[model samples]
Target: MLLLFAVIALILNEAVAWSPTNSYAPGNVSCADDVNLVREASGLSANETAWLKKRDAYTKDALKSFLDRATENFTNSSFVDALWNSGKTPKLGVGCSGGGYRAMLSGAGMLSALDNRTSGADKHGLGGVLQSATYLAGLSGGNWLVGSLAWNNWTSVQDVIDNRGQDDELWDISNSILNPGGINIFSSASRWDQISDAVEAKQHAGFNTSLTDIWGRALSYNFFPTLYRGGEAYTWSTLRDADVFKNAEMPFPISVADGRYPGTEIIDLNSTLFEFNPFEMGSWDPSLNAFTDVKYLGTNVTNGTPVAKGQCVAGFDNTGFIMGTSSTLFNQFLLQLNTTSLSSFLKGIVEDFLDDLSDEYDDIAIYNPNPFRDTEFVASNYSHSVVDSSNLFLVDGGEDGENIPFVPLLQEDRDLDVIFALDNSADTEDYWPAGLSLIATYERQFGPQGKDFAFPYVPDVDTFVQHGLNSKPTFFGCEASNMTDLTRTPPLIVYMPNNRQSYNSNTSTFKMSYDSAQRMQMFQNGFEAVTRNNLTDDSGFAGCVACAIMKRKQESLNMTLPSECTQCFQDYCWDGKTASSSANVSTLGPASGSVSFVTDSATSTSSSSKKNGEPQMPQSHSMSWYVVFTTVLGVALGIM
Candidate 1:
């Protein structure tokens, strides 16, 4: 153990190199003239719209490649050609819901299927949709997946697997974060010291701290190991600095969080939904219809500019903290703390940290220097409780019960055509999604809180189970002109729920550790869920996806619904029907998948595209890492 202490000291020396950079320093420079990054939530930001124009090239190319292959018999060749020439291409968004690691990995899989970069994804599934998409949204664990991909140079899920256990690589979750540095208590102790000291540094700087600070710092290890020393100083706003992000090569990513004020106990549909993107972060609701620069989060701001003259601050929007802000500290941390195998000192540290947070508001991500302080957006009367507060408090994006990150994409000004929603929610008792998210979203649209944002009408959980909407892909908002009491057509929603299509991917949301095989299996299973078994024989399914994507513009242009779309709609679109009886326990997909993948007549693919057939597994991480490096991390610092 003495020799191990020496080894730990060496590792600590290496970690010292990552010690908190001056991310939260008082830069003496005056704020930029236009650094008044806050904008009214009337439409998409100019930065985002401009980026979309730049992204048009990539989206069009991706769509053309995908549609050319999938549109074989579904649409005539002439119509397909007209798609690009007429600029009638659809705008797509992808929303991955919360379910902790289950949501993270399963959402990763579903995206793997849509991602054209995945080998043979286009041939066997809806591969190119990811590239064609304009936005990618996530909440809670789903935010972890999306944020991890977006921050790490827009890496692929396969890349995460390929680089497992390598120094500074992400997704090495074999050891619970509670025990990050192997089972050696001394090593874990060393890590804890680093984490505690980092938090202390922030507090010593006069910022408020919470368990979320410690929680986010700990999470940075698995999502970004280079920061495992508890100095996750990288900011989410730095995404704009990435080469691919600057080039607009990938979909713009957004993570969602719900605002909670002092004394607010429960998050409801009316809770203001805040979105954090690279360019800005704020809520679209009239209550706080304004955004502020995401990079300068810690600086005291009034209206739109800094409160302190000529003093701008940086580094408050730490990447992991933003992810933690969206997830909150409850689901991932408290559920594990107070359990066995923890040192008394460690428990004392956590207990002290918990005691410092706002009374009764423990499930929060603290953001000092609230930019919305006295913010005056379009309607001054509707400003929320946070507008005057010195600090803003946020909780899990799904705490309102809308687990899927849909509110941001639903912004009317964004004018989205369709959203491919991957619902990996653990709404059901057994952990599978049961459509509660959609139901909440649907009902919320009619409430005053909805701000007139339109969404499709949805049935209850019973109907979802009876109709097996959870079992397979389902399209809502199909009734475009047919929708009742709507001012105009809303974006169509293509919801893909996680099911046991190939593997039982419904791992518990709080089950923090994942072996390489479990991770890979979940990834593959999510891929298969969206791609469908023998999807090669099911081209209509892809065509149906295309039809949903095209539906909005197609209606606007008065283009006739193609004969192919008629059948496509019949097979997948959900009509406004409710089940009279209560739902029984629902089990979905083939638990024991069969080799003979049955397909409808619409499934079609050429022989050449079938070469690299089914989704293949990536090289797995060695089990030896379990004993070699169980990297657990913990600490929080703030002066609130």
Candidate 2:
């Protein structure tokens, strides 16, 4: 048929086009250890503070442009300029929450809306917000979005998605990750050999290996845009050398994970939170409160000194490995291979390989030569702790229920004035965030093991849903005096939770795959959620966002509050209230609970193109997705 021919033609047209601008060339890969000769333990490194100073000017210029646009008609527009001219810059951050591929796709949409590079985004979107951010953090699947962007020189998420058929496209999730042909450009058999050989090399080097090694390697094929298929030459520390980052052109990126003592199944607020940034890797928790030079991760160090006089390790901090360590929960994909549609032979291969992993090690990333092994100087004396002799084991950061990775931004030393938290978590029965991440974080700040950081008062989960807070944007800590402690003023929070607008973007957290059309729909849904469908329904949303940005500075300078800001606080900020709740039986589906969905005028701002009520792929894109699906399956079966 003509339709079949058209599909085949599309497949052939896209199969071999490789552009120089989008791909990298072969380069040298060093496996040698490169250690910094000096070692010292410090709570906050001087390098980070110095970098922040260099970044301050850049932030001011970006914020000025954004504020001027958002506050165009406000009477106090002059006050915004005065604050900037007086060197009273507002510090800002953005936090992305985790929920597997659903979270990553939605986070990408929010980031695109924040990025000025998105087409016409500045007209109504939160453009230049990302540029003004001092810190950006992610965990689990959210790490894939942040890590991919950081690794690719802060490439626009729109660009990444648009390049679907190009050879340079890194997020090629149409091909299942377990497919041998999906690993690299080599023949399927050779690619499998390469992956196995690489892991064997690490094991032979006396390092412990876990399912995370394989999981991370598979993820690189989807996230790392390098000519060297497995990202073998791309180390996480190499991000420090990029001219954009070295010159402080982008916000600092932080990836998070939860520390689990061996044999432990429960994760609580007291669990040690570990972070990996460009400069270092370690915990801010008093238990193991020292960071090690990230480039030398595989080195055997004790008491902050290399055990071997001249020995060090460098390449072990591979980009894929670091991302994998932050999202070790993906190892479940390997454990549950039987549940997939993979051919029985391929499923057998996965089962046979994973069968060797013990129950405790199945979900953990093993970091041999633990970086925090001998920290006698730390307050908790973690030198002989459970992790020291047994090595470091980490799982998904959300395991502790603090899914937003806000720990780094909460550090008092950072002094962030506002934070825009994106909640793409699947906390409710319908698989949408119900402020669970925020509640978990607020509770942690008040626990016995709580840090000195202050957080805004968040009501119970019932209050969050009853007020429609999860379905619409809300402001927290808009007034500094409303904070729990006057001495520890926290940053203003602009909470944007995922909701249906152009599409129902709340895909189940366990759903592992998305067609190109579904992926694009998810992006559009998130874009509309954050921008309230480009402020079509609520024209004042943009101005309210600007007010949130200026709250700290306005209060600091003792200037009269703008009328628009005062009105915004009244409309968007939650006033203290509580409600009692008992489970209700009314429901939409057989398995559904008594969920109350809010009806906002904003939800109908735009209509979807799909007649079935779910967003659909365009005709051209639908055919292209079919071609890709057919080719991947064909190649997979051919390899077998």
**Which prediction has the highest lDDT against the true structure?**
1
For residues 1-640, could you state the per-residue lDDT of candidate 1 as single tens digits? 9999789856764543221354322223457654675778777888888998989889988888777766677546456676667777788899999877788988998998998778778777788899999899999889999998988789998687677768766777776666676557677666665666656667667777777777777777678665435335567877887899999999999999988874555467777889999999998887788888787777777887777766777767778788888877332354245434344544554665445432335567878867788777647566458787888888888877788989888887777899999989866656777677887787777666785588877776667776788888889988677765665577899989998877888765656777778888898889888866538436568877877777787777777656888888888888666564332212211112111111000011112211233211100111121222222222211000
Q: Give lDDT: candidate 2, residue 319.
A: 79
Give the TM-score of each candidate: 0.84, 0.82
For model 2, the stretches where C-alpha displacement exceeds 4 angstroms are 1-42, 180-191, 338-358, 380-387, 484-487, 581-640
Cα displacement (angstroms), candidate 2, residue 458, comes to: 0.7
- Which stretches of candidate 1 lie above 4 Å from their native place? 1-29, 33-37, 226-231, 329-349, 353-359, 534-539, 581-640
Cα lDDT of model 2 by residue, 1-640, tens digit: 9999789755543432121111111112233244442233344677787888878878889989998888888877787777777788899999988877888998899888888988767986888999889899988878899999988888888787678878667576655565545545355455555556656666656777777776787788778644355564467877888888888899999999887765554456777778888888887775566688777777676765667766666667777888988777557555543324443434444565455543345557877777767656666533335335548887778777777887778888888999999989876757788776777777777664455577787766666777788898899877787663533888988999999998889875645656677788888888889998988967878888999998988888887767888888888887665344342211111122355321100001112323343332222112233443443454344331
* Deviation (Å) of 119 in candidate 1: 1.7
Candidate 2 TM-score over all chains jointly: 0.82
Q: Enumerate residue pairs that collide in model 2.
A: none
Worst-scoring 10-residue span by lDDT in model 1:
597-606
- Model 1 clash tally, residue pairs: 18
